[model samples]
Target: MIRLPSPAGRRQFGVAVAGVLAFLGQPVPLTAQGFCFHPGPIARCSWFSVTEAGVALSVPSDEDPNLTFQAGALANVGPRSAVGGVLVGAVFQNDVRLGVRARYRRWLTDRLTLDVAPGILLYNGTFTADSPGFTGELALGYADWLGMTAQLDVVPFEFGTET
Candidate 1:
């Protein structure tokens, strides 16, 4: 059996749709003429982990402390422009984060790419922290990611080589 939403639920759905359209930079047009739409090339998705040890301020601490776990997706806006959204969760505590970034990637070589993303971070936990900053990364791709987060031993044909 299937159930339908009430009138209030329908109204809420319309509002959510409107918000999404606004974010995508589409004009709210009641009537329009012919418009050319091109989505262009799509950026590849990548995953990375941050785990390091030692600090100058601290004499000793947990070796290779697990600080954070993040997962996100990257979308290519143009040949060199990309954008992404990420969710971060603390490994040792109950801290959660949500962030979005505008990025630009340069193809250094046929198998290597460099990207820089600057954006804001929003978190909710014991001590809330918000940062508006930029982050950069260099990726060396042979084909795709291997041994990434899981042990699936699968080959991902996205975001690497054209083969």
Candidate 2:
């Protein structure tokens, strides 16, 4: 059975879609002089949906199961490279954790790609000094119609953290 999103969820989805469209609508120059070997049939200026309203099930190292919602948009900057941003949110401990990341992707092969994202993570209801932290993610994915991604995220710096 297909379950529908709640009112709030729907609102978030709408805003995400609008944001992606607005980003894509901006004028940007496309050059074929970038990376990628053996350029495929796709055009150099083509835009790909890196992620669109994707939902993930996550279980932290010492936490309960959580649901994550993510949305992103990327344009092919080169034959084998793309750049974009992903917005993610999770409901944990009755609070919403939100983050926005700038992503850079390099396609090792037509089916495999590496993504690196660095951005800010905000937890709890308010964005206090301690609530915001530096976070980054490294992901490898077999990108296709139905793709699989393995990702790891880490908090590099925190107010009370030791290296």
Pairs in steric clash, model 2 = none
lDDT, candidate 1, 1-163, per-residue tens = 2223334434544554454334444332322221212211233322122221211111254434335443444344444443443333333333332333333444443334454544333322333322222222233332223111210111112243210
For residue 1, give model 2's deviation from the true position in Å.
34
Q: In candidate 1, how many Å is residue 125 off?
A: 1.8
Cα lDDT of model 2 by residue, 1-163, tens digit: 2223335444644664566567666554454333333222125444555443343444445556555665666766566877767777666556565666677778788777777877655432332233344546676666434444444434323345321
On lDDT, the leading prediction is 2
List TM-score per model, in order. 0.37, 0.58
RMSD of candidates 1 onward, in order: 15.8, 8.5
Say what the RMSD of model 2 is.
Answer: 8.5
Error (Å) of candidate 2 at residue 30 is 6.9
Worst 10 residues of 1 by lDDT: 146-155
Give the C-alpha miss distance for residue 51 in model 1, angstroms.
17
